[model samples]
Target: MKEGIFFGEGMKFVKDDYPDIYDAVVGLNKAAYTGKVLDYKTQKLIAIGIVAATGDETATEKQMRSGMNELKITKEEIVDALRVVLLTSGMPAFTKAMKVVSKL
Candidate 1:
């Protein structure tokens, strides 16, 4: 069985630990601020894209997996997002991310 990230005590050393609670708080803020600041769905996609774009393989993998699980993002959408990153971030980052994404 694969272990997914959890928001319990063990992860507090990482920034934005307690993601379960942090997500809730962010949700509340989004609701309060006219409910259209950054859509949750879009935020998830953007986060996955940014992580992948930056070539942070560990974070990119984690965010991609989580975003897919939580948001039902299609593999095609993930691929398309990576393509855009390739255009903007150049080959090195793109190739690195592609290797990891391909493995998944």
Candidate 2:
């Protein structure tokens, strides 16, 4: 399988040791990106916010990079999303997200 930038060592281990479950997860990921109502770029931005809200620095960074690289997402748009996180998820989550965004 091609190496995924966002997928860490644990995901690689699961893909190697639990192929069936990994396949299921891969299927679910595909299903999530089908773009029934929302477009892929929008979905990716939403994913970034959700990941950031969880306070996973690595995942937030990966998602931010992926969104920018693949979807051409603007830093301004990302900051706008983080504003929502600030209002709903609080300053800590927003600050953490800002730190990642600042790096990019």
Candidate 3:
């Protein structure tokens, strides 16, 4: 509850209007917490990479910035991940993703 944030309104919408998706998100949280393949920071970085590779701009931008802030992931690391994505997902797919990363 800060003076001008919309967190409460957004949470209310998720709880009231998107209850089913909200419930699934809770379940997904449990599954995610159970997994331990990578460290939390690494996992977040991988998630950023996947989002970028899939061309999800909103998610990519969010994760890219969050990773840099919370996980201390450097821009160079993100750039390397994008390079791998380029090889696997094709340059055409990665082209837009790289653009998004570069803006970061």
Best by lDDT: 2
Over 4 Å off, model 3: 1-12, 16-23, 33-35
Tens-place lDDT per residue, model 3, 4-96, is 112234656786799887676667655664447766667766777777778777767777787787768888888888888888888865787
Ranking by lDDT: 2, 3, 1
Model 1 poorest ten-residue lDDT run: 1-10
Better-scoring candidate (TM-score), 1 or 3: 3
What would the per-residue lDDT of candidate 1 be over residues 58-98, giving only the tens digit for each residue?
87877777667877876677778888888998888888878
Query: Could you tell me the lDDT of residue 25 within candidate 2?
Result: 76
Q: What order do candidates take by TM-score, descending? A: 2, 3, 1
In model 2, state the lDDT of residue 4.
Answer: 39
For model 3 the local lDDT of residue 19 reads 87
lDDT of each: 0.68, 0.84, 0.70
Q: State in Å the error of residue 58, model 3.
A: 2.4
Q: Stretches of candidate 1 above 4 Å error?
A: 1-10, 13-38
Candidate 1 residue pairs in clash (backbone atoms < 3 Å): none
lDDT of 2 at 77: 91
By summed lDDT, which 10 consecutive residues of candidate 2 come out lowest?
1-10
Q: Count the backbone clashes (under 3 Å) in each candidate.
A: 0, 0, 0
